[model samples]
Target: MLTYEEIMLLITALASVFSVIAVYYAIIEKNLVRAVVFSAIQSTIYAFIYYMFMAPDIVLVYIPVAVGLYPAVILILISKTEKVEKQ
Candidate 1:
């Protein structure tokens, strides 16, 4: 049987992998909106990792800042800039 900590470690590892992939995709995305969305997805995965670490306070703060406010700000900036990359 996996210990609780070991299970959490496993989940954390998965989340880390997912976050890396999400970030990489975000980086390569030509569409600014899509990139912002992908960044939010990565933030959401980080929030889950935070929750798994038993840090609800961090999750609370991180979700709004990382996943919500940050993305919204970027999207707003994108609206003022360009929706899609010119290539």
Candidate 2:
């Protein structure tokens, strides 16, 4: 059976992988909306990783900053940008 630490480590690894993938997609995606969504996904993974590390306070702080405010800000920014032209 896996220990708590081992399980947390595994979860953290998975979250890290997700974060990397999200960042890659965000950078490569042409659509502003898709990039914003990817960035939000990355933030969520980061928050999960922080929770796995047993930093609940960090999770608490990160949740609002990452999952809440950041996405709203990104949405606002994307709304301000001109429409994307499809290739």
Candidate 3:
């Protein structure tokens, strides 16, 4: 059985891996808003990793900026430059 610290490390590693995948999806997605939302999901996972490391301050800031404000701004910008995708 792994120790508590080892398990936490594993979880952090997995979070980073998933974050990378989210970033890849964000880059390839045709929809700008969907890509921004995927990036938010990635940031949320990173916030969870920070929380696991006992860093509440980072979690608070990251959650608001990365998961909340950043996406909101991007969504607003997308709305302003709205273009219909051929599907």
Candidate 4:
């Protein structure tokens, strides 16, 4: 069985990798709404990684701004514009 530290490390690694994939998808997505969702997923993964690292303060602030507020604002802005990229 893996030890506690080993498990935590593995989780962090997996989260980090997934976050990278999320970021890539967010950038390449032509649909604005889908891009926003991917961006939110990346932010949520980051928040979880922060929590795993035991940084409560950073996680608290990041969760509100990155995962919540930023995505909501972007989605609202997307609603005001074209849903898909022209190119």
Residue 22 accuracy (lDDT) in model 4: 98
Model 3 weakest 10-residue run by lDDT: 78-87
Per-residue C-alpha lDDT of model 1 across residues 22-56, encoded as one tens digit per residue: 99999999999999999999999999999998899
lDDT by residue (tens digit), candidate 4, 1-87? 999999999999999999999999999999999999999999999999999999999998999999889989998898998899998
Clashes of 2: 0
Model 2, span 1-87: residue lDDT tens: 999888878878988988999999988888878888899899888888887777999999999998899889878877888545366
Candidates' lDDT values, in order?
Answer: 0.93, 0.86, 0.88, 0.95
Between prediction 2 and prediction 3, the one with superior lDDT is: 3
lDDT of 4 at 18: 99
Model 4 misplacement above 4 A: none
- When 1 and 4 are scored with TM-score, the better candidate is 4
Query: Against the true structure, what is each candidate's TM-score?
Result: 0.91, 0.86, 0.88, 0.93
Number of backbone-clashing residue pairs for each candidate, in the order shown = 0, 0, 0, 0
Over 4 Å off, model 2: 85-87
Once fitted onto the true fold, the runs of candidate 3 whose alpha carbons sit more than 4 angstroms away are 83-87
The C-alpha local distance difference test score for the whole of candidate 4 amounts to 0.95
In candidate 2, the residue pairs with backbone N, CA or C atoms under 3 Å apart (3 or more residues apart, or in different chains) clash, namely none
Cα deviation in Å at residue 8, candidate 4? 0.4
TM-score, candidate number 2: 0.86
